[model samples]
Target: MLSVHEITELSEEFETKTPQEIIQWAADTFWPEIAMSSSFQTQSMPLLHMVTSLNRSIPVFFIDTGYHFWETLMFREKIASEWKINVIDLYRDHRWDVFAKQNIRSLPLEDPNLCCYLHKVQPMQKALKDIKAWISGIRRDQTSVRAHAKILELQENGLLKINPLLNWKKSDVQEYMEEYNLPAHPLYEKGYKSVGCAPCTVAIGVNDDERAGRWAGRGKVECGLHTDMFSKKDIADVQNEFHLDITKVK
Candidate 1:
């Protein structure tokens, strides 16, 4: 129950603390009420290893976007099994099934934002509704939108969003993963620097930004989970961003 002002103050102080220290504080402060989300990508290894190492019981939310690459799903299963992690699978609500099925092929290319909203954002919103805090594996150097994010963000719904790896960079992730002998996503070496749903993701050159492969050439960067889209509770609030006419979605 931290006040907004208090959370802001603490977030500033956290910039000087190690990610592990920040994670430990979050675990101590909110154990059962807290959870973390992972996309099961190569870059996500460090945060996943650190959190589960500290406490194996912390729930991990994995959005099972039905459009994921088969390798991503297999890698996720391998990691969860080997680490004995408490991984929870999240899926889009049944209400969107008919609409989703109808536009299965065109949805991603026609309106990726809406597709992500239905698959990734909405499922995570529903999964996190009962949680007090959410730990995410985003780093500042990954994207321009994430560069300005704080270590702790208090959502409009009062959920505390914690980003322990906010200050970490691509090199830091690589170094930590190597040091800990963490497993990489199967497609990591295949030039899939940043993996997402099949249609939106592509392989990129080695020197490119780690996330350059995600939603390339789509004029879309984020999947809406880390954006203002997450704050909107209803479809009406985000209908303007969609290429699909969602007014008749019922």
Candidate 2:
């Protein structure tokens, strides 16, 4: 457990290092207790390759939202088998039938915040319960909300969160992938800049931002996994509106 001052000092020190060097520091500092959380997106290949190269046995968590594209799932399997790394599949504990009963087949359209909470955030929270530290491939330029994020952060739950590729840009990610001959996500070539659940993703034009296609035209940018989701009133309203049993979500 690193103190706040220690974390700040380390973040400054890591600012000048390459992504691989930062990952190596994390591997040396918190090997057995550290795990990587990957969405297997286009930007993820570089970090995934880097971490596995350091320690193949480090757990890699993939939140299986049960609504991901067939291609994404297939690609996940391909990477897992090729790398022979420990890939843990995390899923929401709720039954689909309950959501279906509430006519919530397309929650991302009706209530994306709740949808993300149930599908992505909750599952990830459960997966990280026993983990001391976690690594992600989030880069500063990926989203405005994440633009100011540091390379190292202490999450609200006291877990250490490490973003080794925080300073990387899209071009850097591409170069890393190309240099290693890593395969791109099948949908990336189809114009999907940011891939999440199949329903919430779309193809983007060349002039758009990398995440412009996500939740397209819905005025929603993030899925609540990376950003704060709801206020107390917001949660209560959602619970009341959908007759949702918040207690059962976790």
Candidate 3:
């Protein structure tokens, strides 16, 4: 029940060791219940490499929104093949017939955050169920919401969410990628800073926030997954519409 700042304080106080060390520590900390979620963004390469290279492979969850660009799909396939690792595909329910009933092919254009919560946040919540801890590559410099995000925290999902690279900056990420000789997302060099559903992602211009390109001009920046999940209004909206009831989401 730590406040966000308190959660961040704990992470900062302990200070993360090498990628290899963090994985080993998590093994001891969360044991068989630990899971890692990845987006295959270039910034994630180092940690992904470290975890996948371990003797016992970590569970790598990918939230395949099914709306990704061809390049993204290609990159994911390539990484999975090259790494020879297990990548569990997590997805939103986009069954065409079911979607057609609501006359919605994507997020309700009228309410993009609502769209994001249903398609992205809620699914991920279910996808990570029963896991005592989850790991991610989110960094503090990515955006305002993430700026306060820490390397380890208790997500309102009630899971012990760990962001090992929370303090990493764009520069630290780049250095790690280069040192590991990792392959970056193809669209990354093409100017896409943040990668997501192609329909929702765009290339960032100079001086723009790293994530500003996503859902550009959509009023909301984060897709709801990064917010203070304890907020009554936000959680209620997800529960009422998408059935992400905290009591039953598991």
Candidates 1 and 2, the one with greater lDDT: 1
Model number with the top TM-score:
1
What is each predicted model's overall lDDT from 0 to 1? 0.90, 0.83, 0.71
lDDT of 2 by residue, 148-195 (tens): 888998887777889989998999998998899999999998998789
User: Which ranges in model 3 have alpha carbons more than 4 Å from their true place?
Assistant: 1-10, 16-20, 94-97, 100-108, 228-250
Q: Which stretches of candidate 1 lie over 4 Å from their true place?
A: 236-250
Provide the clashing-pair count of each candidate structure.
0, 0, 1
Tens-digit lDDT track for model 1 on 27-86?
Answer: 999988999999999999999999999999999999998999999999999999999999
When 1 and 3 are scored with lDDT, the better candidate is: 1
Clash pairs, candidate 1, are: none
**Model 3 agreement with the true structure over 161-213: per-residue lDDT tens digits:** 77777777888878888887889999888788778878788898766777877
Candidate 2: segments with Cα more than 4 A from true spot = 95-97, 100-104, 229-250
2 versus 3: better lDDT goes to = 2
Best by lDDT: 1
